[model samples]
Target chain A: MHRTLHPLTSLCFILFFFVIALFGAPTTQMVGVMILLSAASSIRKRKQAWKKIALYILPIGILLFLVNSAFGAPFSRGLAYALRFVLLITPLVIVLLGGSPTDFRLGLRTVPIPSRLHYLFIFSFEIIQSLRDVFQAVYIGQQLRGYNANRSLGNKWKNIFPLLLPVMLIAISQGLDRSLAFEFKGIESPAEKIYLRTLTLSPFDKLSIAILLLSSLGLIVASFILP
Target chain B: MITIKDLSFRYKQEARNSFEHISLHLQDGQALGVIGPSQAGKTTFAYALAGLLQKHFRGGSLTGTVIFDAQDQAPGTSEIGFVFQDASLQLSGVTETVEEEIAFSLEQFGVPRDIMRERIEEQLSTFHLIGLRYRHPKTLSGGETQMLAIASEAAKHPRLFILDEPTQALDADHVRHLIDFLRVAKRSSTIIFIEQNMSATFELCNHVLFLENGRQQFLGTPHDLLNSNIDVSSLTLPELIDVQRSLGRNHISLLFKETIEWMKKCRTSA
Candidate 1:
């Protein structure tokens, strides 16, 4: 049976990779983790994930290489940072593919975060959920209104100001409306909130976390002793 | 049931009050159609009734007792389901998929997972949105989003349901569906139906609350508003309502099919 792991498990795994990227030697182990994580994301999500990595990571990584090489730093040093960036991002993509926003929030709620911040986290997802579509509609609306987006770079830059303002205004106004919606829905009730998705640390989850932490600790020891 | 006495509200930034001394008494299961020109304070009135004026919009100055039964419920609670004019505003926006959006309100109300699933499916099919169940609600067209908002609110089955221009983004077919939806809803819920267009309200509503310059000009039945000497050009009815009115029919429905049947009956009776 395909049992879904708890969201906190992925979160903890992601934190482990962050630690690895920070402390571990720039070795084949990091590369292996990167490859495994990137591949583990479902094909449908990985398609978009790869696009983001290509668009953002490739440019930043190449830029770092150039800047470091220009400053007389070893080319491999810049490559290490690029790989570290990959380590930081891959687990995030895995979590997005494997888990959901609700699970993520519920998992966060398990942590000792402030109540206001927790509320903000939940409220923000709501805004993003609708604002994304509203922004698209605004773009289409502008196009239909004869303001084409596919113009010269200078013209496109000019259009961005107007486009951005309406999108922001719509988002802000709709956000206020959604706050009211939350109130009407009893989301902000002083009453205790019941989370439907139980966040149990399954035996597999415990085993996975233990294995992940041990591997990172072993890597840390090896990095210092091998040198 | 709701009772609003001596209600006067003014936005902190505005030069004048949105509405003043607006007293209303809505009995259980009564559907009141609020019609007026632009800036008639229909929305403000809705906010006041929903207890949004003071509770949510804190900067505003509001005076009056807007009471719902002896229970004295707080403003904007689960008892009132408001579908705002901008349909997107009505959406909770927290859920990823349309199905989740429809169920978000129910989840907040602490509904069982199984029932939430059932109602989500039922709403999806009822709103003809079964195909878009997995799609992001924010990515939907205006009509689809509006339908989602309505379905989401209806799923909770709140006692006082307020819809502000719910059909503004919808087509005639969807408007018909809404009227049918309201037909069933009115048997239990009190409806505060606000619309610039008088189309679906003619069938879905019983009482009318006509406002002008934020004053209660008339509060009576749909038939009374049609028969009374009120200039309704500003209300913006579809062409069919204008034609039916021109033909001396006091009771005109925006639903073309129903209007056609009514016309046939009138001709045969004559």
Candidate 2:
């Protein structure tokens, strides 16, 4: 809910949620706590709540639930596993859309981590984003150019590969090209860097991070105590 | 100024050279339009100029010399700003906003805070990007993204700027603005423009590099190539040039408006 927190603080909070979801027992208490966090995020941006649920969170959760149950896991356990996925993913969605994108690399850079690792993180992230854009662009371009009065699910399904192959090929080539541009911009240089705005965590950021830590620890302890 | 002599290159495991025995001298403060059809090695040539061919593009037998700033620099260096064909891919993935995108390289170079702020402001206004300064580059229109890419590179103020088909995704108005920007840029930096839009290229570039099938077919002024009896329909020749070739009209126009005005004059005179 605190949108103006330092990007690094936001990152810490998101990572805390992820670690909790990944490692914590799938008890009612853990799920309830994560649900509260997600609900707060959704309530903050009510307009995007439906889209986050329908497009990303719910479908993935449902798919995982189905897979787990099909593999002979008990119904309750499968449901908990699915809920955990949703919980872990919620923090990232909340933070990205809640405010301006975190200066993620800079946030990571402020730590004792080496520059090259952050560089790799930033470069790889961009490449993935670029590839996604290429695929989307190809799909949109195909739809616009091949504007036919198609009225069948079968036709739409069949049309997918025709668009996908070119997108894949273009994405691959562009990825390689971008790697070259990455070095061209002297990103590989070991030069001292300056940011447009250096990140300085406020007292509020520290408080938020502290609260996130306590909450995560409390949920873990509560998970064990609940049963 | 740059001199590239006896340049010939082929990609790894490829049987043929993309371009062979190509040689040209780019003068200071000149815009040379590099035009060719598909698969004519325009992108390859652009890369070579940028100095990427040496290390970035691996396992290629590249011979000859590319001398810029009195040094044999690589394509991806600071001296030669090569705007890739796809502006979207070339974007520094770290920046969240258009302002950040423009400031990205400046930050990398550790440019002083005061100067960086001044440069970002100037670029935003110059490219008509003031309105979209806070907007993310990924969400920008095709033309706006392209302009932002150019502005980002221009802020670095490279000695030689080579753009590979920058106008491909742009509309007429954006293309006009880009050309106008290039006109001013040509006063300071030598520009190697790889473009498909012949008329626009002709409008901005004085020297032309016309390639056909991985070879240099013609290297001269636009007027020289236009006046020559070369039959290439795929190339987007201006209507004025076509009329000049057919009729005895000596009219010169690289734009539709100019062509229309010339036609009216010719009709009235007749």
Candidate 3:
């Protein structure tokens, strides 16, 4: 019952807009895809998550529009481009707000990267995991050692330094050994090259891709017609 | 096929020598088990012997003769391939599949494409890891990871194989598999199996060296140390030794056989 999204899919969700924009996709299509992704992610608690994104985005979007009008570089183009940026930003906010760490892990797994760079890629996440452990270990150790950590600024600040060094050292030593263990198991120095599994372009994905393509073509057509 | 005399080294910042007055000789096809308590310089000794500590990690004055195959050797070209205690740390590949793990090493060794493919298949089945070839090592259990480590190392047949506590994280079944692999490899290569697992020491060691507090406590056959029971408190041993002692069977062959029989009985009962 514990379903997890693949790391590749998470990555795709985050970067799909960037890819679209890079490939000269249109703003409305990008916006539509981003909204779709964000909406999908926020399904469980749609209003709360979606509301937060809108609040943060709406103000900046208005400011950008105002600036574009003042400078006046093709109002439609500016609007489209500004919308494209918004599309790119929404998934990240949704991912950060709505997704669990497991989602990020799944996203990494789904990354369409080359095999040779896999360890390096995974290692970056491992470093973050270790850092998170370091904090939790230190906090637990502090609690066990009878350091009272009440909900007060001064008291919390006082306990910080006393617990910091020991935790850091323990975490560093353990992390090194763990990293070495990872290498020992042939994870660090694999014997073969591997490639990401070929992506099956589903109807949804194809629809998304086609919309992006057509949106880009429409932008080109609109420029010619207007001129 | 390794000779070291008057070898000594000190880390860059540390005042005391990591190793000093170290002299040893290992013959081809001979297996030597290195034993020591935690941080008692077992890894340091192995690293020095393999020329990794001196060459890569540590920098210090070392005045000694390390003659590999009776030839004067430089650092980093050591024929000894090392597998450290932590199987997870030793792996450096990014792929999720077992095939990639073995193939990565073979590629590093510069084996040709056709030979690499053949060797990959051979090792996959040899290590009994063919079923999990497409699985990521991270998803594997501890024993499977250990097996993968050995399998990857086995892909590269080094002249002198140095394994540091190779079976520490493995279960009995996987440990037995590793011992079997080492025993087979011993036919051609000299093994320097550094471990705290005394049962494995007794089972596979032709010779054993006990180190404590950065000093060599005893060096002889397993029977000598197990029988004498002197100056070995610093060295770690398997729990079965204590069990056999309680069973009052200190006889070398009887103690060993009894431990195996007892393990078998437990397995069957379970």
By DockQ, the best candidate is: 2
**lDDT of candidate 2 over B229-257, digit per residue (tens):** 65556587766677765767554455568
Task: Please provide TM-scores, in order, for all candidate models, with all chains considered together.
Answer: 0.78, 0.74, 0.67
List where candidate 3 sits over 4 angstroms from the true fold. A1-82, A87-122, A147-227, B74-80, B112-132, B226-230, B236-270
lDDT of 1 at B57: 75
Q: Chain A TM-score per model, please list them.
A: 0.67, 0.58, 0.55
lDDT of 3: 0.67
Cα deviation of A184 in candidate 3 (Å)?
8.2
Which candidate's lDDT is highest? 2
Error of 3 at A135 (Å): 3.8
What is the clash count of model 3? 49
Q: Which CAPRI level is candidate 1?
A: acceptable
Residue lDDT tens for model 3, B1-270 = 878787777778887776677677778888898887786778888877776565556456767788887779732322345787777666653445788777666654456678777777878877788899989777888778878877777776767788888888888877887888888899888889998887887788888877766666677788887887675666556676766665566553426566798768756977
lDDT of 1 by residue, A57-78 (tens): 6687677667766677897788
* Top candidate when judged by TM-score against the true structure: 1
lDDT for model 1? 0.77
The candidates, ranked best first by TM-score, are 1, 2, 3
| lDDT, residue B184, model 1 | 80
Could you tell me the C-alpha RMSD of candidate 2 in Å?
Answer: 6.2
Question: DockQ values for all predictions?
Answer: 0.44, 0.46, 0.13
